[model samples]
Target: MAFRLTPQDTSFFSLFATSAGLLVDATRELTRLLEVQPSERNAVAERLRTLEHECDEATHELINKVNSSFITPFDREDIHNLAANLDDCMDHIEETADLIVLYRIGEFPSGMAEQFEILSRMSEITAEAMPRLRGLKDLPAYWIEINRLENQADKLHRKMLAELFNNSTDDAVHVIKMKGIIDGFENAADSFEKVAHTIEGIAVKES
Candidate 1:
């Protein structure tokens, strides 16, 4: 049997997944932008800014949904946590885009494009997982795959940062800024993994 839905549940999960989808789209765009030469950077940056604004609007809608709902599909705290985590994922995506513009990061660092690809893939996994909350019995296997992807993201992040710290010249500003951008990618993966965990919890709770 599946969990019963309320309008509140519908609203929350719809917006939650939409927010994640936008994050994935934004990151993918930024990754593609990073691959191009300087001539193509600004145009992608502008699109990313518009996408970020869309993400913010989606987030606010989610918060409003949470506030006005009478009861939620899960514990209020769990719902709140998941909503906030989704918002964090969106914010990190925006931050990564902003850094692409601020840093004028034309060409991607070695393997950086791969990391963005992984982030986009993981965010897709996460958005897919949220709906599985309604069918808790169906989630264990998917959560396992999501965990593996998150682990892959973790390993890739370590290598990406190692190169940044070791190969780049000793420019503190560069180090600090690149580190933050890299961290946003890491956090994006982490947030998606958390969603997997949240799904797992809902599975156990309902099963």
Candidate 2:
């Protein structure tokens, strides 16, 4: 293991883990929303809103901790960026759910279910990577898997857009609404990769 310049307030790792766990929960909620009754989606979206707020709080705590502590587990900038990226991921997840509820989107397109599955896998991989930050062990696998998932998401994203624009019979307004939701999912996946990139950088620097 590489030397970790941690403080007594090593709670940053715990906070990071908690934030990632919230992200996992949020993704699961989205998966459920995709499968459940249309009428039940709004309530599921509300749960996502609550989870997002909690994630925001966790990110804020990480920021405050970074500000107060003279020593951090990694570079202060890396910590802040990682925290922000995690929060951004959760934000996009929440926004996707919100749009579904707000737009009264009837059925989640079958293509989007695949996107949600990718998001869930990304979130799970990220949560697993969070604790590994303390030791910087076996992290290459984490980032590699994240990159693979992001690529899969990109392929799905392109297919969804192609299907929506070319073959769908839905009205322009409805297609536009779905485009926004798809954008959110794509953005969320990108954010996870960003976090992975940040961790990869920090690990290289620390090593």
> For this target, which candidate reaches the highest lDDT against the unseen true structure?
2
Q: What is the alpha-carbon lDDT of model 2 when measured against the actual structure? A: 0.91
Give lDDT per model, in order.
0.74, 0.91
> Candidate 1: misplaced stretches above 4 Å?
1-9
Instruction: Identify the runs in model 2 with alpha carbons over 4 angstroms from their true place.
Output: 1-8
Candidate 2 vs. true structure, TM-score: 0.96
Candidate 1: minimum summed lDDT over ten consecutive residues — where?
1-10
**Residue lDDT tens for model 1, 30-49:** 67676677767777777777
